[model samples]
Target: MLTPTGEIVAEARRLGVGAGAFNVITVEHAEAVVSGAEAAGCAVILQISENAVRFHHGRLAPIAAAARAVAELSTVAVGLHLDHVESDELFDQAAANGFGSAMYDASKLEYADNVAATACAVARGHAAGLWVESELGEVGGKDGAHKPGVRTNPAEAAAFVQSTGVDALAVAVGSSHAMTNRDARLDHELIELLHDAVSVPLVLHGSSGVPDDELRAAVRGGLVKINIGTALNIAFTGAIRAAIAQDVTVVDPRKYLRTARHDMAETVTKALRVLTGATP
Candidate 1:
């Protein structure tokens, strides 16, 4: 069933578990995520990033509509979210295109500027009946700048959430984005502190970098929303490579794409199990 992002997150919070949000760049990605959520019997969030929109020539409606269709067909609850949207135009487009939630990322700006921009975005999102999410600081690994030492200050994070009136807060806690290696270490103590100080559920961006045990510990410590992208892409591409290697004469895209989708689904299922502590 199609569910609102706020409702899904609220449920996860009530259950003391983390909700997995997977990035979907294509229809196959959305389908795989829904399949994984159904397999795990847990709610899932499907996210479309700004870069993905750009990849489609700044068009969001097509992909967003596809995701909505997938959600409608899904037996398990699913939410569509716009991720890392830095522009008002794209944010408005996402809301107009049926995204139930969006992340307005202005972390590159100065602190006060970020707050002001995010606050405006929050008001707009709420007016459109969308749950808003925003990041306080850069999480790292953006454009090849890997600053693993950077972390979000609990005080600043709480203040940002309060001032912006965002429904969720994504924080920097020693995890870097675009990480191919799943060995990132999260600051469990900071996660607990942020959870205690902030009114909204804590969102961990760059979660694909964090290992399974650390991800489990992060969720147990207080993180509620886990956003993953790179890991799924890795699994998907690996499957495609393996499929081609096994059948050198295969020219049909569906043959290899089927394997990719299935592999990606398995990865998402594992992530959901780790986040929700579901029995496999």
Candidate 2:
């Protein structure tokens, strides 16, 4: 069943649990997430990032359509979300395309500018009845704000949410993006402080780098929405690489793609268990 991201996040926050928001680069990724969610009997978010739109030649309609179709067909609850979107035009398209939620990323701008841009975005998203999310700090990856010590100030975070009226907030707290290794240490105490300071659900980006025990600990501290991307890419790419390497003569793409999708699904199920504190 297709579910609203706000509903899922709200439930998780209310129950003091974590909601998994897994990024999707292709249709298979979305399918695998839903499949894993069904196996775990949990609701999962399907996130499509701005980079993915660029990968598809700056077109979001096709990928958005594919995700919606997959979500509608799934037995488990699924929510479609646009992740790390910085363009107003693209953000507009999210609501036009029937996305239940979107994260308007203006964290790259100066503090005041980010708040101004994000506030306007929140108003626009709210007008379209979309649950809006904005990032306060750069969750360290790529360039700029990649420093390991950078973390979101609980006082500043509370002010940003208050000024922007965003439905949720993603704060930097030690994790960096695109980390293949899962050794990132999160500030558990800061997470608790931010949770107490902010009125809305807290989102943790760059969560792929956080270990399972840390993830469970983060949830216990106050993270409601957990964003994961690189881990799936790692799982998918690794499985495909191994399958192809083992059989040099195999030429069919489906043979290897099947293994990749299955492996990714397994990863999602395990992550869900950790976030929800279920016995794996």
Candidate 3:
């Protein structure tokens, strides 16, 4: 059931639906995501971030192989994606490492530099048959360079997409990254304008901070690909905390990890339902 990431995004765009992309740090996370997608009966993208690569001490082959295996065994359609890829070497390795799509993040660089770097990434990704995603302006960060106030201009976004030849563009509307609270307010009007203006599919990053109602509204406003990471980490960590606390005598790692995995799966299932408007 391995599907192309572009197919999922394009179909979602045509239907005005959200194509959920969940980040996976561990093989268990991949399994949980697949389980959740199957429960919701929808296709999903499993993302591996640059930060995650660093977490694994710069090793990607093992985890990437595991994710590919999980995707092959999945009942629901699944695709692998690379998120927030800052390094050229890492981005270049994505296709060979089993990723169907990748987001090249040059948002930290100067505008011209970002365009140049992202354009280069787009060409390489396209050559590898990978769906290329890039950000015009960052969606969120505590840093001054990419804060909550940053918003992508519709015209500029359109131009960027056209110039870079990217498959999709992540626009800054209102969401902030790593928000523990789901209270981010998105500009529905801007989202619609961006969608109409841009030639490619629109992406909403830092979606974990967005509320469910707003999420559905974003889809209605033409957000096709939604990147969600912090929410899964929140669920995974919260469950681990609860499980370990309930049984202090538990020495087995699997005992607590099992609880965490199940909770994360439930969270993913809910998110998929919200994005796809699936029945509970």
Q: Which stretches of candidate 2 lie over 4 Å from their true place?
A: 144-147
lDDT by residue (tens digit), candidate 1, 1-280: 8889999999999999999999999899999999988898889999999999999888898999999999999999899999999889999877678889999999888899999999999998999999999998679988854355778999998888879999999998889888999889888999899989999998999989899999989999889999999988998999999999998999999999998999999999999999988877
Off-target runs (Cα >4 Å) in candidate 3 are 142-145
Q: Relative to the true structure, how large is the alpha-carbon lDDT of every model? A: 0.91, 0.91, 0.89
Worst 10-residue lDDT window, candidate 1: 142-151
**Per-model C-alpha RMSD:** 1.1, 1.0, 1.1
For candidate 1, the per-residue lDDT at 276 reads 89
lDDT of 2 by residue, 1-280 (tens): 7789999999988888899999999988998898888899888999999989989899999999999999999888899999999889999999888699999999878999999999999999999989999998778885564555678999999999999999999988888989999999999999999989999999999999999989999999999999999999999999999998999899999999999999999999999988888888
Segments in model 1 whose C-alpha atoms lie over 4 Å from true places: 145-147
Q: Kindly state the number of residue pairs that clash in model 3.
A: 0
Better of 1 and 3 by lDDT: 1
TM-score of each: 0.97, 0.98, 0.97
Per residue, candidate 3 scores C-alpha lDDT tens digits across 82-173 of 89898999999999988899999999888888889999999999999899999987777634557667889999898888888999999999
